[model samples]
Target: KEFLQWYIKEQGEEEENSEANVKNIKEAGDDLSAVDEKMGTRGG
Candidate 1:
């Protein structure tokens, strides 16, 4: 039960972060390539 709850919480956090990143990408109009490159660098 404890592990299930922790797993659900982690999933929610990851989903929220993905949502935020999508929003940022959309807002980053006319410069997606630059934004993507920066994100890749940071992720790598």
Candidate 2:
């Protein structure tokens, strides 16, 4: 039960992070190449 609760919390955090990244990418618009380069270097 403890592991299940922890896993759910982690998943929620990951989802939020992913959504934020997507939003950032979308907002980058014409500068998407820069975003991709940054993410690639960060190994994200």
Candidate 3:
């Protein structure tokens, strides 16, 4: 019973971490695209 509870807790933490990582990656991609647009404007 104790082992099962610990395992469930660890899995929940891991799932949360994975979700945060995905969100961070998406935000970074958005930032990069914005920077690219800014650079393009400067060139023009």
14 in model 2: Cα distance from truth in Å?
A: 1.0
Against the true structure, whose lDDT is highest?
3
lDDT of 2 by residue, 1-44 (tens): 99967766776689887677667767787488787889899996
Q: Sort by lDDT, best first: what order? A: 3, 1, 2
Model 1 Cα RMSD, Å?
9.5
Ranking of predictions according to TM-score: 3, 2, 1
Residues 1-44, model 1: lDDT tens digits: 99967766776689987677667667786487788889999999
Q: Please give each candidate's TM-score.
A: 0.36, 0.36, 0.63
Clashes of each: 0, 0, 0
Worst 10 residues of 1 by lDDT: 21-30
Whole-model Cα lDDT per candidate? 0.76, 0.76, 0.83
Error of 1 at 1 (Å): 39
- Residue-pair clash count for candidate 2: 0
